[model samples]
Target: MTKRIRKAVFPVAGLGTRFLPATKSIPKEMLTIVDRPVLQHVVEEAREAGIEHFIFVTGRNKAVIEDHFDIAYELEETLQKRGKLKEYQALTEQLPPAGATSFTRQQAPLGLGHAVWCARELVGDEPFAVLLPDMVTMPAPAQRDRCLAQCIEAYATHGGNIIAVEETPWEEAHQYGIVSVGKDFGRSFEITGMVEKPPKGTAPSNLMISGRYILGPEIFRILEKGEKGAGGEIQLTDGMKTLSKHQPFHGVRFDGKTFDCGSKLGFLAANVAFALTNPEIAAPFKAELQKIFGTL
Candidate 1:
């Protein structure tokens, strides 16, 4: 039987250098989209996917991220005194039980692989999931699972390193780590190999890796060596490629629209996209957007 995937590791230690001055104090994960911070959206997706224990591989100056999931007692009490029951419930509703969550530090700004390696001890030998907070995806209400949830389904069946992949235009393959596909499985495929930003036409396929992954524990051993690649950082892609040689490696092409929140333009696009769907602001927001676009 396949081992149940109960824990998830979120690597959110990057110093948001791309959005520098604003990120100078606040961790990028805490940046708000619509109303909640970016990390909240990732956590909510993990929860929806039946991830029981949330493990955040965080870094320096990220205490606020930890606090975001904890009970805000004073605020709760104030809400109670003011008879704002709805407000109080909203704050505490999504927070995981205290013991169900864990935070471990990624002491250096090494890379994605090293950041994931930071939580190795906490994860132990279980199959785990990794959701990159930078890529926030939204699926239509009619769709069953978001990207990560679908990735988990792929893991439960294939039981190895299964990552969420999406098709990009062949010409833009150089912008992302591309995957060479084999044995098409309808919903997923056997990931023959991965190319980190393959040179234009040199890319084997247009299928690019999305930020959600379900990895077997053996990948930890590979990441521990900490060898640097692509920008002198320990790349998780490197570790996954090594693990794929020995373990079953596959990819799940998710059915959702992923928003890249790592860049300023992507961030702004997500906010607008989210707001347009938000009931509270949808009407006014659409009118305002039309007014602005008309003037432009």
Candidate 2:
């Protein structure tokens, strides 16, 4: 039997150079989507998917991300005293139970593969999930599966590595790590190969690897080689490609929309998309948007 996937590693060490000077002091993961931080949204997804241990690979100036998960006794007390019971409950509801969360430093911005390697000791020897907090996935109204949960479900059947993939326009496929599959399996397919940012029009397929993955401990061994690819950094795609040679790799087309919060346009779109989903604000926000669009 495959070992249960109880732990998840979150890579949150990026400098967020794209969103400066706001990120000059604040970690990009802390940027708000709707009313909650991007990192919080991903964590909640993992929690809903039954993840028990939340491991964050962090860097300098990322203490805020860690603190966000920790309990705030003073703030909670103040809320209680002010008769803000509902707000207080919501605040406490977000806190991970003690000892469930762990933080490890990346020390340098080597790349995503290195960040995952940093969490090796914490992850031990088992299949675990990796979530890039920069990517926030929201399920469509009729869809019930969260992106990570969908990958986990695929992992159970395939028993190897599961990558959350989505289709990108063929014209823009070169901007991401694209996967080539061998066998069509409906929602998922057997991943035969992965090319990171292949030359324009040279990609094998348009299914880009989104920011979520469920990988086995064997991946750590390949990442340990420290091979650099694409951007002269330790690329996780490179490691996954090497692992695919020995393990069964599959890509699951998740049932949701993914917002690349690392980009300016994607971030703004995510704010509008998520805001439109809020019951309390959706109606008024839609009206406001309609008004703004009418003027244009």
* Winner by lDDT: 2
Best by TM-score: 2
lDDT of 2 by residue, 1-296 (tens): 77789999999999999999999999999999988899999999999899999999999999999889988889999999999998998888888888999999999999999999999999999999999999999987898878999998888888899999999999999999999988999999999999999999899999999999999899999998988988899999999999888899999998889999999998999999999999989999999999999999
Q: Which residue ranges in model 2 land beyond 4 Å of their true spot?
A: none
Clashing pairs in 2: none
lDDT tens digits by residue: candidate 1, 1-296: 78988999999888999989999999999999988999999999999999999999988899999899998889999999999998788888879976999999988889899999999999999889999999999886678789988887887778778989888888888999888888888998899898787777899988889899999899899999998988899999888988989987889888878888999998999999999989999999999999999999
Candidate 1 is scored at a TM of 0.97
